[model samples]
Target: MFLASSAKPIDESLQNLVVEIETQNPDLLVVAARQLRYSLQQTNIELTITEPRPFNVLEEFIIRAGIEFEPAPTPQELASLLGLDPVFVQSTIKNLQKLQTLAPKSPITVTEQGRLFYDKGAVPQPPYAVQIYAIADSLGETVNFQAEPLNEVVINLPSLTSILQLNESNNLISTFNLEQVQKNLQASGLGLHVPETGKIVTAFRSIGSTQTIWRKISLFLIFDSTTEKLTIHLRRGKQMLDSRSKWLDLLLSEGKISLDTLCKLPNESLNFEREAAKKYQNAETAARLEKIHQQALGNSQKKEVIQLRDREINQKFLEIINTAKQQIIIYATWLNHLNINPEFIAALEALAKRGVSIIISYGLEWEPENLLEIKEKLQAIKTPEDLPSVQLLGLEEDVYLQEIIIDREIYQCGFYHWRNSHESHIPLGELVYQVKKSQIIQEAYEILSTRCQNYAQKLWQQAVEKCDIQLARECLCIWGTLGKLETSLNQIQKNNWLELLPIYLNVVIHNLKSHNLADDSPILQSSLLLLSQVEAEAAFIEQLRLAYCQLLSAIAQQNPDTALNLLNNEVWAQFLRLHIAAETDSPTEFISQQTSQPKTKRKAAAPSTRNKKTKA
Candidate 1:
């Protein structure tokens, strides 16, 4: 039989796509062409109408498209994103849907094969820490969060909200759900042990709350100068319970503490119920005050007729605002009356009544006073029980997008936040006039949301200049969480962030240079493979003169073995040549400088927690 199939002529993008057709009969062959474009209806990538289609070729195309391309773009949108034909995009998207490679969900969801391919393609997999860091960063970008404790996801990290709190999805951290150990975790004291400087601070907490009633703990992290070891300290304080709630039962069984801390007394004394009645009396008073307040907030105001396109956008935005269970993040630079409108404020006030924490982040301006005044008013619209939180950035960040996230259920992000009421400022390409910015380029995304949240957290971390025990220890604990990796070298490859290596190396170099040498500054040793790569592409090592000198000096003073390792590496030798005081290219001058200071060994701390090797 002759080879015949219904894909139209292949484009440049589909040309690179690896398609595999599993034919039922070995002898039969098929020829594929690119499909239709702008038909208003749909077509297939491989239209084999004669017999039972294997669907393998279709699945392969979808998997490749999904993993490699982004924003879950449709074949049409993907074509636009990649500068391909709309017909080719449409055909590819249809075939993928037929084969079930792409989920029917909006913005498209890739099948498991797509996920696995993306995971396995990393040249070297960054360990869990980097993955966590990267995830947190993505969430922050997706949801434009402002400053507040636990408000941002911190990049590449498991969703902090997903991990810390439960939602309708019940997608909490499966390994160690906080609910299982909530009492202990929420009441515990947070500590970060930094061996570099012996300084320590007793308390670390959110603003307004004076005492450090930690919601999370940072285990001690030690970076060994002699061995390049990263240890995650695990030892925890009291108030933590054993899983299964047995810790409390076990504690009561053991008869350890008094009735003061445990859930209940084993025996009910005559004094108890009478004491509870008085508590009820006080609650009754509070209920009466709540009733009075509720009367003040009469019937919901009449809905405004917004002139925006797509009525669905308005409905969805209000739905998210009205039904947020936990957290709401509004990152809008343009907060004027024309932009924000009255309906938006009413939604915000309604959610405030439900104890949904709302954070309003205005874009950073040259002068922040006007934004601060706006924030003051937003904060004023609060219920007696729950107050809306507003953050006026002292930041100089110039992000031009507005993002709104209601828990993880809904998210909206776009460049429309930059537009003012003036028609001149409207985006030139977007012809759809009535659509809300959130709906115009609909990318209903979760990963991007997580990334946005994570990015915000890192920004917060970077913003904190002082190294109190809490901040220092928390930052250091990442090394401890880094655990078995020993150095960023083994871990860097796993992340598949080779393209971003120059940026990362610059950061590591900055850290090394800034750290005080007397403070037992730790150097992250890298494999010769990575170092050579860095040396060839970016020349990162050559730029780190003081850092290289400090590292060589430390190795020379303490670990002769480490000094041998560096000297043996060909990539490091060329970098070392830049530091030769005189001629003749010898690292002995830097080594000599290192030897001048007597090396004092600071003892490394042991890993503190159980499951010492597992990812936190």
Candidate 2:
């Protein structure tokens, strides 16, 4: 029953023995060691096993054998027996103690049961514990018997040749299966879902190796449904690259790209398509809603308003153009100097080319001299077979007035013609309806269009036939006469004439003057004569005389200073005396006496201050 004590070196033989035992009875080592130690100790067998190793390799066996010793094995002896360096063994033991794997136990010692009579130590009992100690040493030191859980498996294939050599094995079949799976995903437009806890079992061969290798590679994938995010987790694999979102946005914005090509991509491409589909669906919904809203609202009223305004403007514009039968007269504040816009020049050019008369008057501010430059450029054309030559008049003086008279019947007056510096240099002008078909307007247009040399002939004929100047003078006199009449008339009658008489006079005068007819000029003489012939009071005659004088003054003021100076001396002095008398309550006798005085010699001078301030 004694335990054996021996120091044996670890060798291949012992390793083989442990391997055989582990294979035969894997569960026996621990159970057998415990059973043998308990059985030998029950027989009171004392065993002592000593080692010089610093770590106590036999300490556990010694304790179980019920033996006590003064010193344990030395460090070097423990190191040799365990096939480990002394430092490593000592550190490991210390660590085990700190981990509480080796807890404190009562030390075995010889002691008397009763008070102090030591029977001279009876022959020490045979050390039966040595046999159990030896068995415990063998069991604990058996590395092959240690059980390890199958945590991971690895295989290596040195080359492709080795893989081919192992064709008969399942490795080839597994490789083929993986390839087939990849192909199926590519063909079906399905993406492979790698499991979150799965591993990649790779089988490969070295370049010239005879054997194939198998390795388990870790991999995982996650799909977050809430966020619509897909992530592939590969422990030892490269990430996939795709430009699905970019390509999809491009296709959505441009509405050009083939859908068939997208669907033909491999399984890995599905994530991109998923995102694209969501975006496209949202856009489609929004567009459909917008279309529905637009359909519900009608635009009939808006269309009608636009149509009415357009028609009114167009009709007025056409009337202005059509009135220019023989000649077109235009007075624009500024004209498009570059001749690039719609202007009187553009219209007149068309008309003149067609043998119709055209005349234009525009301010010098518009750079009308530029017209000459343009003319030069046009003239430079080597082949001027059919281009029309246009006449331009730049009014550097008296340029403040802006008006257009077309063929006497049509006239336009407004600020619409001036193109502001900040605005586009386009022609824009308004037309005023005058006679609507009067001879006066027609003559004005003709006069404007006449050649410079022919202007005098036209003027002479107009003075006689139309008497435009005389009519204008008569109208001025009538306007003054009407103002005096309003004071003597009844309130109701005054209002009626106030509204009607001026309108009638304006229409008649405009018709006569526009046609250049001087026939209405006799109205001035006839009206004056009628007053003188009437047996009316001196006051009434004085009123008429004063009106005549004022009309003359207005005429003088509006005309050139030279024209005003051309008046007859006697006639001019008489007119001036009449105007002065109208402003005062002078005796009729005094006015008559003043008028009888001989005309005094006077220097040629501009119109008087009273006349110069008179408005047309």
Q: Which candidate is the best by TM-score?
A: 1
Clashes of 2: 44
Candidate 1 lDDT over 466-526, as tens digits, reads: 4232332222222221121233333346433243333333333322232211223334445
As a TM-score, model 1 comes out at 0.23
lDDT of 2 at 165: 32
Per-residue CA lDDT of model 2 for 424-459, tens digit only, reads 443343322223334434443443333222322323
For all candidates in order, the CA lDDT equals: 0.36, 0.32
User: Given candidate 1, what's the lDDT at residue 563?
Assistant: 57
lDDT of 1 at 277: 34
Model 2's TM-score against the true structure: 0.19
TM-score of each: 0.23, 0.19
